[model samples]
Target: MNTPADRATRVQDIVTVFLLSITAVLTAWCGFESSKWGGEMSIAFSQASSARVQAAAAAGEARDARQFDLQIYTQWVVATADEREQLAAYVEDRFPERLKVAFDAWVDGGMAEDSPLVVDAYVAPGDAEAADLTARADGKFQEALENNQRGDNYSLLTVMFALVLFLGAMSQRDITRWVSRTLLGLGVVVALVGIGLLTTFPIKI
Candidate 1:
């Protein structure tokens, strides 16, 4: 019922549709992957930033607490037993009291990502406010320290999750399998390095 030329044209149209379908599918798949990767990257960045801020806060607070303890101890050294007891009681009340207030301040400030302002708030130099800042620094330092410590863990987990997500993104067949495997391995290595850096880097008190 059909001429040879008509049959040939029909076949060509079918082939064209097939090719276009393949391309569309591939594009859609890649777009999905890209979106996922973007999300993971964003989450990782946020967590890393938060962790850094917390670490700084914790370290600053711990140092301040130590210094406060030292000052209190110094004061206790020259005082009478009754005076020392009074001072001890005062310190017990004051340090904990200030700690509560400073902690509330830190949290109310939104536990934001690390910035120069946050660091400056905790560790300013050559200022006569060291005495006043001691409590604040101690509180922030402790918060930051705890965060850094947890950051190591969080970073490691995120790296692992990224590796998995990347692998999923590369669901194409006929490519070298080694490429994906190699990327996974490299991700692990990168995660280890991040952990090492966090562990080895000494924070300023």
Candidate 2:
């Protein structure tokens, strides 16, 4: 034998409890996803840093190898210009394998290029490997940034859910029925919007 007002109050209480429960679960899920994405971001950043260091080392090796090749090639040029055939031969014989291949190609091409350094075949020892590692580092860095953004999105959603929870709690307080209903309505709207946004975000285990 409940009056209409009593029945309405009971309905409000039920709606508030439902909203609070659902909002709490969603907030927890958002927090968990944010943490997972943060961990993924950290791992990606670490991998990126490791790759960068290895790339730098490899690039340094390539630079040093190229410098050595340049010095040997200069010696060969000077000996050849002075018509010192034996000295030129000695320098040529000691050319690094990469340089020797390019030198041979240059000679076969009637010495058309200014130097074997310009030849396509003259790749420094670690040049290709360094380039590959650098690309890998760049890719990992970009991935880390994307992961960080995803974590931020989840954090924002967690805040949104928290707001919904607040609204739901306020709705359950002793206030005017209309005001209570308004707060509950707002909480429901916010929760729906949050769920929509959450669906758009990627999930990370």
Candidate 3:
């Protein structure tokens, strides 16, 4: 103490208690934030998994549709001239609603059996919709991954807050003045940083 006393004064003891309490509060806050982030990450992961499954199913359906169209085209190729005209008319009539715009354009431009209207990416009406689903599913997965990373950040801060608590406990000793000061300073700095992170992170709670 500056009062020529070897023992700590009342003000020093109060300061020590205040610092210890701050560390404890910050530790709890960080722990809560970490838990909230983890829960949110879990929810995000669940949504992503669901979307992925849906995308896979839609892709399979699109493949099946493509196969059906290809089969019809194959049958048309082996038919007689009269049968060929009838089959072609049937094929044109059965063309997908989603593909009508392109099919009409192809007709206007002189319809060909090998045109891109059927051979391109969207073989069926749902194929284009399925591709859109795949893109949306991928976006959900990316969002989930970002949430997982932010959860990990909160977990790291939880550890840092725990360390602050440990350092605070260590500071309450009859060590050398510099050693005590070092421990206290470390605890305060870590607590401040932990609180900052908990507030700024995407974890709402």
Candidate 4:
């Protein structure tokens, strides 16, 4: 009862179903990984920025406060020295510890990020090394941002592929048309859920 065109259509429909299934699964997995990766990248940058700010604040407070007098301001000088040491430890140790894992993860995934080592930033101020590290961090943040965007795109494509497959699988009859439309609607809803996650999940560095 089937013509050549009908047979070809049926074969194409089968292929569509397989492609859609594969794409849908991949999209879901990729989207989840992207979200988690972006969040970790953002946290790393934020902690670095905080460490930098704390160091600068300590330096500025030491410079402005009186340190020559030992009568009443001796406590201030001691506090300033303590603050400087704390700042050094934070930049050289704490920040690096926080970012080491995320940086390694990115690199192992065949992507690289700015080093979190704060040796130059703390040991030698106003140098090229500090500038380079900051610039590298910004680049890494942008890379993570792009990855998140790519995830959204892939998810949308998967939904479109699913709709095409559903339509191809349906007959031209009224009941089949209704079923196809329902499936397409569900696809759209799932895709929108993905979009919501893409926007809401924190990626800001």
Candidate 5:
């Protein structure tokens, strides 16, 4: 009843079950990780897209501001004393009242080349806000790129899980111990790689 062949067969069965159980666990873990990464990627993409749209709107506003700057320069170049005063009034009306001090200084200096109004130092607050949005959009795009890469890494891990499941299943069917062992070993190697990737790939949940 306790024959060596029966005992050996039982041992093989136990080993097969162990391998299958381990492979199933690994597959489940990989599937969950892939899902988590995918979700993060979507969120990142949405943020990036929203930032891009806001940045575009800000850039458009900046273009309008730049056009106004050009108009002011043109008026200053051609205006008589009365027209120059009118141009100054127009600039005051175009921007917030807070900028009057800077505007007055710029005009008192004869609108010289070194005028602070020509640069961001005295430029409208809206223009500065637009510039900030452009920089923010670039930063969002970079984050989206990094998240996409992390999603790809998790996707690759899912593929590796497939292989592990396949090879481990094959080990259950192979008649020779060496063949079964080899297949199981290959699965282990793939699982190891997936595990290593898990350590490096970014994830939140």
Candidate 6:
């Protein structure tokens, strides 16, 4: 014949088993999510690095193009000041399409206020592309930081679930009934809190 104490002990054992099992699964899930978010962060960082390199390359190209255009414009200016029409025409013919547009606009404006280099139409090659690539790199860097924070959040939940597992295992000891029940109750409370926090995190996989 099972006494009331035996029945209560049996019930406590069942609840402890259930709590341990559920908390173990939740712990594993948190670890998995943390790993996934870490991978995402690495990938985002790599993409940001690649974009930064490309942006730097584009900026270098723009600088070189601008310098070449300046050299050509200086030659043209010297030829024009010396009244060498043929030399000026020769240098003007060699102007890149980008510089030619600005030069034509400057000439049309009576060459009064600003030089071709300062003209609105004087966009060096790769300038816009470099600016766009830089913006993309900045965005990717921000995304990487966000991913890292998400991974950290999941890691914290994993630690919380581990504490719950510890408490649930301790409840199975040969302690007094009330003490065992208290440990089990604490474990359940911790597990519930961890689950609530888990719900708020973004899922990566």
lDDT of each candidate versus the true structure: 0.47, 0.93, 0.68, 0.49, 0.69, 0.93
- The TM-score of predicted model 5 comes to 0.75
How many Å off is the CA of 203 in candidate 2? 1.1
Per-residue lDDT of model 1, residues 1-205, tens digit only? 9999768546644543443344344334434444454445455556556555555666576676647644654454445355677765565455344343543454567756232123224432223344444445455456555545454444444444444344334422235546644544454454455445444533322
Q: Stretches of candidate 1 above 4 Å error?
A: 1-12, 73-205
lDDT of each residue in 1-205, candidate 3, tens digit only: 3564444545545666887787677666666766776777678777767777777787788787667655654554455345778867777677566454555665566666465345343356455666777777777777777777776787788688778767867777878767876887888888887778777877465
lDDT of 5: 0.69
Clashing pairs in 4: none
| Cα RMSD for candidates in order | 18.2, 1.2, 3.4, 16.9, 3.7, 1.7
TM-scores, one per candidate: 0.33, 0.95, 0.78, 0.37, 0.75, 0.92
How should the candidates be ordered by lDDT, best one leading?
Answer: 2, 6, 5, 3, 4, 1
How many steric overlaps are in each model, in order?
19, 0, 0, 0, 0, 0
lDDT (Cα, tens digit) per residue for candidate 2, span 1-205:
9999999989888888988998899999999999999999999999999999999999999999989999999999999999999999999999999999999999998899999988898899778989999999999999999999999999999999999999998888889889989999999999999999999999987
Residue lDDT tens for model 6, 117-185: 888878988899999999999999999999999999999999999999899999998888788899999
Question: Which runs of model 6 end up more than 4 angstroms from their true locations?
Answer: 108-114
RMSD of 5: 3.7
Q: What lDDT does model 4 reach?
A: 0.49
For residue 145, what is the lDDT in candidate 6?
98
Q: What TM value does model 1 have?
A: 0.33
Error of 1 at 64 (Å): 1.0
Poorest lDDT segment (10 consecutive residues) of candidate 3: 116-125
- TM-score head-to-head 1 vs 6, winner: 6
Q: Which scores higher on lDDT, 2 or 4?
A: 2
